[model samples]
Target: MLILKQLILGLLLPAVVGGGIFIFAKSLAWKKESEQKKARLSGWLVAVALSAGYTVGYTGLEGLPPFPPREGVHWLCYLSIIGLISGAFWHSSRWGRLIVQIALSIVIPRLLLNSAFKYTWGQFEGIIWWMCLAVAVFIFWHIVQESFTILPAGGSSPFVYFGLSGGTALVLAVSGSLRLAQHAGILVAIFAASWVITFVRQRSDNNKWQVFPLGASPVVALLLLGIWMNGYFYEEVPAASAILLAIALFLAPVGRIEKIQRLGARRSAIVQICVIALPVVIAIGIAVARSGLFGESSSY
Candidate 1:
């Protein structure tokens, strides 16, 4: 009975919430009153299934041999639930909507992992890793897309929010665990700066061609600043690189004036950043804690 309760609460909530949202969205798309909107929604759903679903499925399918049955089952459940929520949010371009999606898809899983990390060996893989990879890819693609166009010369796309929130959470964890609060706090502050600058630039629609200071080019400059900081402290390949690349790609393509402006509408800053950062940070924290810092394996 206790096992049943734990299973229902731990696994069922996500499955139901994620599946319910997706089904509801599909239902709305199919309704006659919203056919036009529905059509667009349908197209996005298909695209998401293709893009997000393909990643989830590929990771499971390709990584099957070594994965245990219990682990595989857990991953399938997580992947399906996450994909559903992400697909729902990715369907819209609004910041609020995207934030909700990221909360459901990325934040929940991270919380779960954190909890497990405290209680047990707390290791997880399968869908969690795939979702991280998928979200990272999605953010990178948008960063590159926005860099040449919609973003002002040194401005970043809205994806920096994830860097701020997720990166801060990561710093907090490492700080608490490794007794590196000063260093972690500094990194978190830098991430916040990146988010603020990116948000302002996004709101203003700035697109100048010169490298501004940290605030001037928050997306590119701040991200690089964060990456440099992380690389200095943490030996892990800084997951913040996606945002940094987006910054560089945009700056490099600024010379193609006509090509840059045509990049079209951008995604919200909050959702994209959360999607990109949350999973990677969670994975890194867990992997580091369990595997031991500096690449040494735990005797346990």
Candidate 2:
């Protein structure tokens, strides 16, 4: 019953909010290319807003009030606001988009690392290790951003990615923190709902598919944060496996896969599914092995 409630709230509530934003954007005149661009930006802004509100509300419900030490939630809220504001300027200038990307790169890694160190590890050590992790996260974000940018506009690939994130959340829920998993589920629901409506409206208008930082940034950030928190703090998942899973998730954008790249969207999506599944299978196998060992040791 509790799971059902979380699923509905996590999925349904954000869907409504996202759907509303899509409707409003579609209702606009958008006669000029500039107007259409702004409309699309506005939709992303709404996505960020939904993400922030849902994060705050979800965490609060879990008895973690919006306060210090719960810095992860606060950082998410801050990122969403900054993303929405910065994203508004994205369509106006190249410098604006670059600024937003840089801001996210700086803030998100710091936030996730801080949360992991403070809440899970209890102290920040190994400066070189920390730097390496931060660098990896930044690179991963860049790859995801590039992936979204290159995907055929109006293509449903992004939605598929979002759905995969939700699946990741469910896996975490079973193996790690339920609260974090619920938050991830909510993020997926919001984005998925918004994407469907936006795809349909844009199809009707014949608008090219474009990527918005506001929507993609938080989703990726939240997913990485969840993985780190679950692996380090909860210790339900093995840290090495979690790190490998994170690395694998970002590998989908590697352009070296010539055979997969040549295929059409439908075939390409199938290839992506196969690529994503490989790491997930490995991670799950590691997790299961660890759990079995722990169980045997405990029985002793």
Candidate 3:
């Protein structure tokens, strides 16, 4: 019953709230001035939409966020607000976004992995793990953000993220932690909503360069990394499996390469997604086999 409720809260609630707000924003106008308004608000709006979905899901499943965040999930609620605030810098300038990215990279891993060091590991091991996670966060964010920028932008472009979110959700589920899986699934839902809105609104508009949330990629990337870290620390998820899942999302920008770009959007998208699926599939297989047979996963 809890899992079932998780689906509705994570999937249904976010789709309605986020998608509805975006649609309403479109209903306002298509004039240049109106578009200017959207341009300014678009990235922030994307952050808002994603945060709303995450916040409601967290609160519904876990209850309202408490002061100082006693639980890790509670920290996620606070992180959502942080993501939104930091995401605004994405629109400001590349330098501005990079600074925020660096800051978040340092912060998120420490927040999530502190429990591992405090409760299970020695200070040396903790420092090593924390450094690795922080590096991972910065590297992943830079790769995904830069690649998405180079990739052909269209209504349904950035498809790799949708795949990443769905695949992460699956791995999280099998690795143990229904709540984190659902949260990952909510990411899939939010992107699915974006695809629909982009298709409907972007197709007719002449301004393909309009201000979009593509700049706000860090929020989504860090959010996924955070969820994956939570699974690794709390659920005994295998290190290799977690590693593979993170690598999968980074492959999407390969479609934007000069050789691949010649193939056009449809063909390139197919090739890109195939590249992504390979790691995700292998990760899932490893998680399934080890958990079911070898029982070799590590945990705090």
lDDT of 3 by residue, 44-148 (tens): 676677777667767666778888766566677777878777766666686877777888888888777667678888989888887887888999887766655
**What would the TM-scores of all predictions be?**
0.28, 0.72, 0.85
The number of residue pairs in model 3 that clash at the backbone is 0
Poorest 10 consecutive residues by lDDT, candidate 1: 209-218
Best-matching candidate per lDDT:
3
lDDT of 3: 0.72
Sort by TM-score, best first. 3, 2, 1
Which 10 successive residues of model 2 have the least lDDT summed?
291-300
By lDDT, the better pick of 2 and 3 is 3
Q: How many pairs of residues in model 1 come into backbone collision? A: 9
Clashes of each: 9, 2, 0
Instruction: Give per-residue CA lDDT, model 2, range 1-300, as digits (tens).
Output: 876666555667656765565455445424436855655555465545455545543553454446453555445444445555554554566676666566665555556557565554534463554666656656766665565654445534456456556655645655656766666666676667667776776768777555343344544554455455444444465665576566655656543367777886657766775676577666655655665645641110
Q: Which pairs clash in the backbone of model 3?
A: none
Candidate 2, position 149, lDDT: 56
Which ten contiguous residues of candidate 3 have the minimum total lDDT? 206-215
The lDDT of each candidate is 0.37, 0.56, 0.72
